[model samples]
Target: MKRTWIKKSLLVILLVGILFVLAGTVYLKMNTYAPSEAALAVAKTGKSEDQILFFEGEQGKPAIIFYQGALVEKESYSLWAQEVAKAGYPVYLVATPLNLPVLQQNAAEAIIAEHQLTAVVMGGHSLGGVMSSRFVSSHLDHAIKGVFFLASYPDEKGSLENFSGSVLSITGDRDGVLNQEAYQEAQRFLPDQTVYEVIAGGNHAGFGSYGEQKGDQSATITNEEQQTQISQLLIRWLENLE
Candidate 1:
């Protein structure tokens, strides 16, 4: 009788431990993430990143290629990508090199050669926009249908003579990182073909990662709101493009 009682007690303890672990796992997953979720998730290392050829958009339209901000990983752009994709165009988010050596430019060169990119639209946030400009300027081809500048600084390092393509420049009314006056002045010199969109109360870091981009911890808005606003504006602007 003593041995029987001990065995029953141990079994109850073991079952309780298993139930606790299962409950903890479920709670974690509820707060954390799942693979199929559209939010950004990191790509594993050691796997060959795929080529930049065209990704299929809705209704057979051309795709938009998204370039990520400096130090902002590709996973961080996944939410933005899905929003754009929902607007009838699929999105390809490219990884910029650590050195930032016009890496996407090289990727574009290879991608353009292999893919039948019908109407390419390039857009990026902050430094990523600068890199996109570099890629478009060097390519010198009409394959790029248009360009979107998201809280970005124009290419001051190079002459803006070659950026004659359609431009959609977006900056928040309260953006501190990008010089609005400088961007406006630069737009004036660009052959009179640029459009600017300003979001009220939106700031500079609102353009990128929620935590990583907000070093000062002084950001005034949530990432979900910013992503929704920016993505919606981009889609509406792209739709207006001829």
Candidate 2:
């Protein structure tokens, strides 16, 4: 009877484990956000080199390497990249492993080695942005001019306070998912002169072309409007910095 009971328990445990694995698989698949209409449009002229999608804008223009959020498709940033490209900056979107930037921390290395850009601005959204901060802080000698964050913050693990480059952090007022308290706390980790902006009525997912996130609030402006504002403001800031 003891042996029979032991076998039954083992079988039950195996079934439970299988169920959990199946559930996790379903969650990951269902959360795969599709690219917006603008993403499809940008795909026409996009170029790929070393697994990074490059929006070739103009020669000698500033190059921006943007990373995608966790579980979010890399091309979900196409709309914004296109706008940045229109502003005469080459935008390179790094494709992360399983759409997780944290898994591939050195994803920017390939882009930097191949692009031959003089001054590079590196950034990402959410988790992606955090890893981007890590890359920039470690690679200060690579001529990194600036770091941008979209609904993201530089945590204590990797602070940007000592970084001699510019920092641009853009957030949304109505973002329900981003940790408000943590965001405020992380401000100390950034440089004193960080250029921070809060978009009125923008939500957490406003920075990307992805669909509505689980806990995100409704954005007052369309994705196009937000992307336009971001690209325009970024270009203006880049121009005025000199």
Candidate 3:
């Protein structure tokens, strides 16, 4: 009888665990930020396969693998990706499970291998950037050419202090959603030569087209203006990469 009771208890725990996981998954899916109509319109021009949105560019340039911000739809970055692709660098906007890059931080490896990409740059906005940094740090042998962050910073575990690759960090001057203290602290983890820039009238939500984020400050500049500057900065940086 005791053995049977123990078995029943185990079954009950297993059932509870499964229920908890299901509930969490549903919650995450429901809370996701969908792309706006403008973003959706731009995304239609790109080709999507599986979870990746591919923006084709020049044949022999470094490819970009970008992850999406937490709970933000991958399509939200479509407009920016299209602009970058026009500059001759193919861009792959990757969608993460539950819209959280942290859940699949090493996703770029598959993309790199699938396309046989040699020179590659990995970047993202907000939480996506943090995970991309973690991936770069963990896969140093991948020979990533550069890393870029939008309103984000790497965590201690994803530090690139000794990395030789190029690093660029762009943040908005009026970003209320970004943790200033943490961002300042994370700077020590970046390489000495990292290039940092700030958009004069930008805010946290200006990095993507997912509408105004809960904690972000109002941007003086339009989203289109912010994105244009970002793409220009990114293209110039990419062109100058060694």
Q: Which predicted model would earn the best lDDT?
A: 3
**Global Cα lDDT for candidate 3:** 0.92
lDDT of 2 by residue, 101-197 (tens): 8989778877788767787888899998899998887787887888899999887766898898788999988898899999999999899879988
Q: What's the lDDT for residue 177 in model 1? A: 64
Question: In model 1, which runs have C-alpha deviations exceeding 4 angstroms?
Answer: 1-38, 41-56, 99-104, 156-164, 212-217
Find the 10 residues in a row with the least total lDDT in model 3: 233-242
Tell me the whole-model lDDT of each prediction, alpha carbons only.
0.63, 0.83, 0.92
lDDT of candidate 3 over 1-242, digit per residue (tens): 99999999999999999999999999988888888899899999999998999999998888999989899999999888999999899999999989999999999999999899998999989999999999999999996999999999999889998789899999999899999999999999999989999999999888888889888899999989998999988998889884
Q: How many collisions per candidate?
A: 0, 0, 0
Q: Quick one: RMSD of model 2?
A: 3.4
Q: Give the per-residue Cα lDDT of candidate 2 at 5.
A: 100
- Give the Cα-based TM-score of candidate 3 against the true structure: 0.95
lDDT-better candidate, 2 vs 3 = 3
TM-score of each: 0.70, 0.87, 0.95
Model 3: clashing residue pairs?
A: none
